[model samples]
Structure formats: structure tokens, C-alpha cells
Target: MNKLSDEKPNTSGVLSAAARDARMTFGDKAKDQLKEAIEIVNATAKGLGISVGSTATAMLDIHSVAFGSGSISLHDETGIPLRGMGTGSKRLLTAGLHKEASKSKSIALIDEIETGLEPHRIVRFLKSLGSKDAEPTMQVFATSHSPIALQELSFNQVFIVRHDKPGGKTSVLAAPSDAQGALRATSSSFLAKSVLVCEGKTEIGFVRGIDLFRVEVRDKESVDAAGVSLLDCDGGSETRPFERAASFQALGYRVAVFIDNDRPIPEAEATAFVERGGALFHWAEGQSIEDAIICSATGSIVLAILEAAERLNPDDFDLLDSKIKSASGGKLNFEDAKSFAEMDCLSSEQKAWIAKAAGGKKGWFKDIGRMEALAREVVGPRFEDFDEPFKKVLKSIIMWATR
Candidate 1:
């Protein structure tokens, strides 16, 4: 059995040692036999596109074999020395050597298998590490930070390592077979102790904002300190959120989902999720996070949102005013802004417009750091004054994360 590393090998010393060992075994005929064997090996290696020093002239005094090429060198694809080979080529060669050297009882440990390797080649590299039809039953353990690698492996073969900040602890969770695709799509979530599978960028921004507010204004721990990760699912696709949540749950993570009530979830799926002890947080019926915020927040918070919107997009004010007037059925007045329901019946377009105005893709929420800063200012000390529904949803997420 032999151990091979991706690190560059000392080719000259390795070949010299092999030559010395052959001399001890074969005695008088060793030199001729060793030279012949070297020529054959070099030719075969070259034919297979592998680089090897081509000559084996005897140098018994120094106990070394001289190469016909003058210096011992492993040539690359274009015939450059191994010393000049790129990282990918080096890694590929190292992996090949390890696979060839492995035996039935061998255990191979690799770090960052995706390093310097193209995404397309990762699958082939993994397959070569072991095979059911081969005599050498090799067992391999590898670490990777690439989603491409995850796509090549099943959930059961992948493990999530999560670090807990509060208690300073770490734990590993195995991925569930069913959520392989979702896990691969958002592989970074596996690094968090708790996961918040958000519907979209808006929800992600809102939660991050609240987490900032809690830390700066309320003097409470932030979500990051609690080891909670927020995963944006692009948007609340019919099955994306559920699939992601299920994948996290399968890994023994305390998973919570935050979505708008505008989209309906299948009853069977919802029941199964609850039965599995997953927490689901949704906005009010037919409402989104934007709608709930505007409807449930106090007069000051609503005013702040409007102010933020005006700063974000000055030209959209007239359009917003017209929409508000149409929804309110009259001129905008302080008295009419009592509740979300009373303010206006918001359409999806209106919700999107308001969200954009208050800092959607191009606004303060565009940069997570900026969003956290804005949240600190907008949220202020009156954290409890935030809309009840939004507050409740956030509370549920925080509770699950802390637990």
C-alpha cells in the first residue's frame, strides 16, 4: 500500500530509490534489466499522455539513473516540465497516481478535491477514486466547497459541518437523499447551524434588516451570532422552498421557511412538513412581506418606508401617489393610513412597486451591508412597533434558530 498526495513529488529521488532497490534484488543483471524496464515504462507513460524522464543510463557511483533528456523531468501535455505544469494538471496527475496505488484496504483522505480542477472533470475524478468492479476496494474521504462536487454526490454521501457561535460547538449533518438537487443548488446553507429558507431577495433583505436592528438598537444578538443562515430561493417557486426546507430538515437542522401567503402550498406537503416538526411562517392571506409591513407598522414606520422609497427612486413618487389614491379611493391623508387593509387593496404590481421603492434589487437592500445599516436607522428602538404579522414571523424564525 502507498499514500499519494496532490503535492508535487520528488521524481528524481523516487526513481533513484527504486533503482537502488532493484539492484539489491536482481544483483548482477540489475543494471541492464532496470534500464530496459525504465525505457518500457517511459514509453508506455508517454503513449498514455503522462510525462516521465525518458532515459535510464546507469550512474552507479551516485546510485542514480541518468535520463536521455539530460535532466529528470515529467513533461506536461505540451511537453513542458512538471515543475511548470498548471495546478489543474498537477492535481489530475496526483489523483491518477493515488487511484493506481490504492488497494482493497486503502483509505484516502483528500482536502478540497475541487481545487484547481474544472467543474466538468470533477465527476470523472470522483468516479476514479473507487469502483465496484475493481480489485482495489478504495474508500475515499474528500472535502469540497463547490456545488459542482455536490451535484456528483448523493445526499447521504455528503455531510454538512455547522458551527455554533453561542456555545462554540460544531456538528456534522448528513444530507437527505430526497433533497440532493436543492442541496446542490444552495450548497452554502450546509455551513449554517440553522437555515432560513426565504422566498426571495425581499424577504432576505427584511430578515437581515431585522437581525441588524436587534443587534444595534435592541442590544440583542444578531442572527449570524446565533449561527442562522438566510438562503434566498430566487423567489417562492411552487416547490423550491419546500424542497429546500425538506433538505435542511433531513440534515437535522432547525429549518424555518418564510414565504408570502399569496402563493398556496400543497396540503399534503404542508401536513408532512409540520409532521416532521418544521416551522412555516407566512404573511397574511393575499399579502406579501411588503404589504404586511405597510399595513401593520405604526405611522412612523410607514413614514420611514415612504421616506426610504423617495430617496431610492425620486421619479416613482407620482406613480406611487396615484396607486395609493386609486387604492384608497381618494386623496392621500394621514387619517386614511390606519391599517394595511384600510390603506388600499394592493395588487401584485403595487406590492412589487412598493418593494422596489423601499429598496428592492437596486435600492438599499441591493447590498446586504447597506441594508443592515438602513435597517438600523429605520427599525430604531421601537422594534416591537413593527407590524405584528412581520414581528410574529421574525420571532418564529429567531426562536427556531436559537434553539
Candidate 2:
């Protein structure tokens, strides 16, 4: 968890005095004071959907001071402090405030939100911010290096601030694609952008993965620039991308569909989808989207893999041989399971070399860490602001591969 310090404490003495007064109060007077304090803090955090432990703790501390006591006693709707005070009273007091926050519609903005909180608490914080009753205008924004915080936000909401000089002026600004425009563009895609429907997560992952790679490899002047959004339809079942596209289109969105050519059902169904104003991409006989990825290696997979490799030790991911051999059910005799499938069939020695380079059983090429590291490196100094460029590259790869 990230440790967040107080916001320079406008006046420590004033805050300390406030705390003293609150701490000295007791009983009915104390309860009333703390309740009002809790309400004030909740109101202050309004419009920001997320809150960190520091914000919560700080507010509680202030309440403690306001009541002039060791702890602020909170009452439930029954007008009784939970469990009737003493020993477990502090804990009950904390719980009471939590219950109130949970029920409140105010958005939370915690500075250094991860500070002093465990993973579970952080997740809870995000959940509270994302509550069903959370006001539509409420949204959370926080700064932290914790993976948990990153996980809490969608890829689009993770903002990167950088310092740059253009036209002799140095300023701090959200990177080009990192701006609110890109975020809103991607976030509200179901209503705004074109929806390219695909079958499964891997398909969605591959497209998004490839697009992010292109954003890193190519420059802005290149064809088909970034800002494209990928939304997973969660398979061809009821919530499939096609269904999502249709729904979004009905609500006034320009939606398109892309599906695999798996046997009778997907192929036949895809044709009908295209006829209904959707776009289609079919995998060849017996080929799934993963295979399509291999087929489009030249324009798609290789670049992404290369980008990943560049970020770390490229020598780490030789899964080509094993994947192919596995795909062939051990019929093919290749040395390593870690070779690049795009590298045209290789000799046993080359495969062995790949396996050797791939090193551990988890193969570097398949590691998400390796991929992200490579993405950060290839995307370079400009990577901090990665949205626009990535979308462009992804679209080009799809267009090039499918073409």
C-alpha cells in the first residue's frame, strides 16, 4: 500500500486544537460532534468515487479531536452506540463510520490512496467507490505505484503525467493520449466509438495486445494511429460481442463484428452477422483465433513479441517450438517449446537454442511482466501517454493481417 502524507496540514496547531477539543468531549455531545464530522468529510469527498485509507483515517482522527476523546463514538439508526462502548468500542466506532460511508453516495478522492492499507482493504475501497448507488457524477482518482490501484482502474483510467517542453515552454501535462479526451473516448465507447465485435477474451486480448504493441513500435506519422477501443463481448453466448455491438448500435453507436471461422456454426453465423451491417473476419478450416494470430505473425504477433522482448531479455521467450509441437500433439520434432511460431519452421538445434534462451518453465515470451516491460521501453519517453498511438498501431495490424 502507498503511504500518503497529509496535504501539508495547512496549520498543524489548528488541527491539533480541533483534535483536542473533540477528544475532550464525551457521551451525547461527543456522539453528535463525531456524527457531524463524519457527514462533513463524506460531503467533502463528494464527486470523487474513490477513497484511500489515509482519507478515511484522517477523517476519523479529526472526528476524534472534535469529540475531544480517544475515539469518536458513532451511533446507529437506533440512537445507540454499537455494543454500548468500552474495550471493543473503538472497533465498533470505526465500523459505524464505515457503514455510513458504504451507504453514502459521495465520491472519494484519496491522496496516495494505497497508503497503509492491505490488498483486501484496497479492493473494498474500489468496490465502495463503484457501488451500485454511487452517483453517476462520482469518480475516483488517486496516485500510486501499487499494482492493486492499477488493477482497480480500467487501462484507460490509469493516467501518466509527464514534464515536457514544446515551443520553448516547459509544463506538466497528461501525455498526449493520456488526456481525459482519450479516456472518455475509450470509456464511453459503447455509445461513442465503433464496436468491433470478437468472440472470446483471447481474441479480444490478442487484438488489444497487438494494438498496444503497434502503438509502441510505430510513430505518430504512421498509418492507422491510436485511440481504438476493444470491448470483450465475453464469448458467443448471450453476452457475445455481436450481441453487444447490436445493442450499442440500437442505442446509436457505430458497431462492427469480427468472428472466427470455426466449423459450421461460427462461419455460417458470421456471414449472417456481416449481412446485418457487421464486419467479419473468419479463421480458416480448423483454425481458431489463436491460429489467426500465428498467420498474421508478420504484421501482428512478431512486432508485439519483439516489443516485449526489447523491454526485457528477448532470449527468455522461446515458446514457438513447444506451442507448435503441442499444437501438433507431439508429432513434430522440434527442440524447444519456446520458439517464435512466426520464424518459419526451425531445425532441432534452433528449437533447442530457443528453449535454452526462454530459460525457465514459464517462458519469458509468455510473461505479462515481460510484455509490459517491453511496452514501456518501446513506447519510450512518450509511453507515459500511450492511448492514441496504441490504438492506431492496433488497427493497422488488424487491417494488415486480415487484408
Each candidate: what lDDT?
Answer: 0.63, 0.44
TM-score of each: 0.60, 0.38
lDDT of 1 by residue, 79-110 (tens): 34454555655666566656655554678888
Model 2: CA > 4 A from native: 1-192, 221-227, 234-239, 265-272, 293-330, 336-403
Steric clash pairs (candidate 1): 295-340
* Candidate 2 TM-score over all chains jointly: 0.38
Clashes of each: 1, 34
**lDDT (Cα) of model 2:** 0.44
